[model samples]
Target: MATATTTAVFPLLLLFAAAVAVPSSPYLSPTTLFQNYQKMLTNFKIFIYTPAKPFTFQNPAASLFYSSLLNSPFLTQEPTEAHLFLIPFSPETSTRSLARLVRDLRINHPYWNRSLGADHFFVSPTGIDYSADRNALELKKNSVQISVFPVISGKFIPHKDITLPPVNLAARFISAVPENASTSSFLGYLKWDGKTESNFVEELRKDGDFLIDIERELLDPVENVKNSKFCLLFYAGDVAWMVEAMALGCVPVVIVDRPIQDLPLTDVLRWSDLGLLVAARGGAKRLKEVLNDVSEEKYNVMREMASAASKHLVWNEEPQPLDAFHMVIYQLWLRRHTIRYARRESF
Candidate 1:
């Protein structure tokens, strides 16, 4: 009996002896990426655990993912056939409760102990602050995390975690950029609170080049964005503007205080191809110089690219082909092979 058990476990241990290295190149050919996406749609399967007891209420934000997964083709009832196990935790779920839930999963299941959560995952709308609860964070360190605000190297581990795109229903009504540059009435536009003492905003105000609105002054802000060549987007704890600007066909000059990978589907799409990243190190004058340096031709190209890429940022009721839902799933599929025991396959 001992020899039989040893023989059975030895093969599984040998299979995970070496870890596969991910490709160094950040960008993959779209053709190859989409091909893998198709494969994932066909083959990838997810198992969402059914708790022994039903909760009193479902979180509004977390319910979006839960409902989508429940309706998705990837869901599986049989855990033995699943490639990933999802812990459907709301963003408001307490650290203590989360720890307890994970403990229960381990105690009641063989899968958690078998792989130590290498194939498990959870969705958090507001992203996790890994430093807040070190003990709780350590419990599921090996599991994949899907979030809206995943910060690379900080709260999120690239290649192991997925950055989910926030839902925006308004994207459906937005129009793409006109083929003619002459259609743009303004060089840039920004809706400022007029209170934040941002050096970038002040500099742009001093230059008198951009149409800056204080408060909700504009009759229709969306229309103004459509008429502008570029949108001055400042990331002040919110990412709604990024998708909004892109969807409206306005090339975004994303003014970020620090370097971050907040954009969704970054692994498959090159953000630099669509929008500009203006570092705060240079202040407003630097922003002016960067925007001014762009040729009319380059700006038009980027505007077109932004419009094309915005499709990946929109979340539909039913998951669409190459939309945000598929993008998140693709990211999860890629991470499935990140575990030491999982075999790496080329897309």
Candidate 2:
């Protein structure tokens, strides 16, 4: 069973990894990265702990990710051969329930005790926090957490914890702009709701460089994005907007003040190549300077890259080559070196 699973999975993953043209590090050759990725594909095995009842997710990102993982060839029923153990649960599942699940795994399975969850991982769009209640410290501290929001805090350790793109599985309302579509009216478009009101945000709203579409006034929100050269994104809780903006062929200008992170697929996709990142700390004046400074030649290059990178953010019904699902697997493969497995007694 493991042999069959291994054989079927490797080629798809290898193809996905090979298709990634951008190297995460300039020092590493593409051939070296591909070789490393091939090794991960051949050896990495995941053991998903069966839940007492099947999980039902309300969030599309969580639903698609969990379901796709179950059907993927990385799954192995044999615990002894597993490199990572996945604790499957819905995003709506309470922290208490999640902690209980971990406790059950610790008591029932010998694997959890081997490395104390150093090789374990879980996927949550909103993220799991056992720290607030002062519970499951081992799992919280040791296990790899894959979340859509990778905040710049102690809560989300970059490179240690993984980032998953918040994928909207629904069919796009506007897939592509028409060939004869009108030229962009504004340099950038921001969908604002006045929820997070600040001097900087308000200043940006009135700036001539951007077209601020107040949420209540939006007739066609997607169209606003399509008609703009750049789509402004401010991360509140969800990042589905980032994916949407990318799919619409709009270059994303991710704005975050401090706590939040805007980059997804840090290892797989070159974010700088696709879009511009503006730190909100500089306020509207600085932001305008940065956006205006972008040369016409540079903007064209980013627009082209954004179009190509858009497919990687979408969650297809069936996992496709170099899609979000395969990219997460690649990230996990990169972090596989952190796993310290204990020697087991032979039967």
Off by over 4 Å in 1: 1-28, 52-62, 131-135, 138-140, 150-153, 194-199, 340-347
Candidate 1: tens digits of C-alpha lDDT, residues 1-347 = 22333344354334222212222122345556745655676778889888645542243324555677778878888998888888776466777877777777878888776666778888765556543343355434667877664343466766576777656678756655455654787778887877654666777777666788777588998878888888886655344666777877788777776776757787776677677888767877777788878888777777766776677777777655666776777788887765533312100
Off by over 4 Å in 2: 1-43, 90-100, 130-135, 150-154, 169-183, 198-201, 259-262, 339-347
Model 1: clashing residue pairs? none
Give lDDT per model, in order.
Answer: 0.67, 0.68
Cα displacement (Å) at residue 162, model 1: 1.8
Reference-based TM-score of each model: 0.81, 0.79
lDDT string for model 2 (178-225, tens) is: 332237777788877666545666897677767887663888877777
lDDT score, candidate 1:
0.67
TM-score of 1: 0.81
Q: What is the lDDT for 246 in model 2?
A: 70
